[model samples]
Target chain A: MSARATTRPGGRSARVQQSVHQAVRDLEAEVGRDALTVPLIAARAGVTPSTVYRRWGDLRELLSDVAVERLRPDTAPADHGGLRADLEAWAAQFAEEMSSTAGRTYIRDALLGDPGQGNAVRCSDYAVEQLKAIGVRAAGRGEAVPDVETLLDVLVAPLMYRILFRPSDLSTVYTDHLVAAALGRGPATPQTKS
Target chain B: MSARATTRPGGRSARVQQSVHQAVRDLEAEVGRDALTVPLIAARAGVTPSTVYRRWGDLRELLSDVAVERLRPDTAPADHGGLRADLEAWAAQFAEEMSSTAGRTYIRDALLGDPGQGNAVRCSDYAVEQLKAIGVRAAGRGEAVPDVETLLDVLVAPLMYRILFRPSDLSTVYTDHLVAAALGRGPATPQTKS
Candidate 1:
């Protein structure tokens, strides 16, 4: 109804903030980032442009927040034991991130063919660093260097490639198989749907 | 200035074609795909947008052509070994493409952060098919399948991820290392620079 909506909640204006954040995600998830604008986000969130600006700064910053949320890992119970547990946990996390509608959208949008190279370059560098950090964390627990790096690469690369390139749906079993293969615990087999 | 630079004899037209093509590439190389426009391309080429439109149709069509040329592999020498050679050859082709300035721009503009999903999906699918075709050919030559694919994936996926994430220098030596590592042909210490 209004040109824009800034719905913050709590006390004076926190309600407006929460409402507007939800609306921004909704607008992007629905029509996509290309279609989203301050005006549109404001309208959906039931707030004004000024309010949206006051809170989120700009569209890029808003999208960055959404992207970050989509990428946050959902940790699993660490009881599987040995590298398998770590591998499974990591692979499942990978699958979860790539398989989500929002995650997929974010990754898809972040690639080379989208809009801005500067943003793409920065985002890609950040992701690489994220992978590197994860690799370092694994190594702290006695994982070797090339071993740790290659292990991470093998466990996650296929899932990533599948998400990017193919229609074939990879499975948790495939993830497990890959981890097993990497750990020299089993053979690497090609996967079909679960 | 004849449009048929690549077609003319004495390699004169070839030079023109190379010059104009390089001009387009340089523009992409300098500012990347986001800042790429017919006006910018024309200015870079020291021509007019009318000339560019006349030569390459529209910007989309021109870019498509540029992408095709920039990425397609020149016929390289074949190996008599087996699937490993085939896979290496194929991966090397891709690595070379991704290493070029134009290729970097294409991937950065096409698949990196904010890469449009549809375009990324289409291109990545086409790339997989291309890899599959190479594998099939390798199989015909008596190369193994499961190992070949795994080896090939190990090589290509990392390269793709690097291209997607690095957005900087790419090199033939780097591809050679990927090929070596994936095939277990030699050590892969990750020769990073250049």
Candidate 2:
């Protein structure tokens, strides 16, 4: 459940969706992702298998739906005084979260069975929206910031490419380098975590 | 069959692998990806289902193997007179080839069920090798070109991100922009095909 769930607070449809989503999360933790089925999820949610089928069509789509919900950020990115510091902190945290095992799983799940790329767009939009907020904050403070697309190309894409295809090569040093490069700064200095 | 197949020219294992890979290609073209099964692939390859199971473990692994083979470039990137021209041409072609429907399918297949991430690494190595070749050519010509890692981050990553997640938003203009950015050039001027 996301902001949508809050809008339709008392709706039966929203309740069923919440219950089904909860069941999926519980079953994933209890058994694992591979063992999940519509009937099992429906049973756990106190709903009929037909209801699950009607709502989600199949296991893959259901998984995609759940993944999208999980990937939605709970809050706007934290403001860190200047645009450079704000972007650096955001990019560092983003790399850390997205490169994790569970994070990669969610990303893959979000893309699987996404024929229309709707789920993929939804996921990308989350990043886009967050970046836009950062840009707005920088502009308000009279600090120039790179456009959202530039940030995506220079920062987000590299992180995702590493997550999907070269997880072993990804490092905090690399993330810091990308943030610096995106801002048209000179060569990177390796960041030490506090 | 790749160069590996040539090394063991007439070996029984190589023969089996070639036949199986060929069968997968033909079947994929004929009946499509979703209808594929281990038994069907084995039958098509003139091998028993048990043989396929014993060799490949499952359909997903078999698909990954075929995808890796197909993703391997047939030849080294064609060199242009200058490093900038060579990189721009290569990036444009790479963007075109990878963003197609079949190409996207191959990428997905290569990644699916890849527990060891061996397939993913292999696919990445293909790009790495190509970029290295381009770099070598530039160095030979005494043209100071950007490093392969920079190309991967500023060029390949964006193409892949769009192909996997935001395909509709990707354009030739964007591809050209990435190449320019990677080369440390100013704003891109759109290229027209001859």
Candidate that scores best on DockQ: 2
lDDT tens per residue, model 1, A90-176 = 667667767666566666544422333444455444444545555566676666433434543455556666676544456676777
Supply the global lDDT for candidate 2. Answer: 0.79
Off by over 4 Å in 1: A1-23, A26-35, A40-65, A74-79, A112-148, A185-187, A191-194, B1-86, B108-122, B125-148, B166-174, B184-194
* Interface root-mean-square deviation, each candidate: 4.1, 2.9
lDDT of 2 by residue, B1-194 (tens): 12223234788899988988888888988998889998999999999999889998999899988888878887888888788788878887787778777788788888875767789888888999998998998899998877777777788888888788775445656677778888787432233211
Q: Name the docking class for model 2.
A: medium
- Model 1 Cα displacement at B119 (Å)? 4.7
Considering only N, C-alpha and C atoms within 3 Å, which residue pairs clash in candidate 2? none
- Model 1 lDDT at residue B164: 58
* Model 2 per-residue lDDT at A133: 93
Q: Native contacts retained per candidate? A: 0.37, 0.65
- Model 1 lDDT, residue A102, Cα: 59
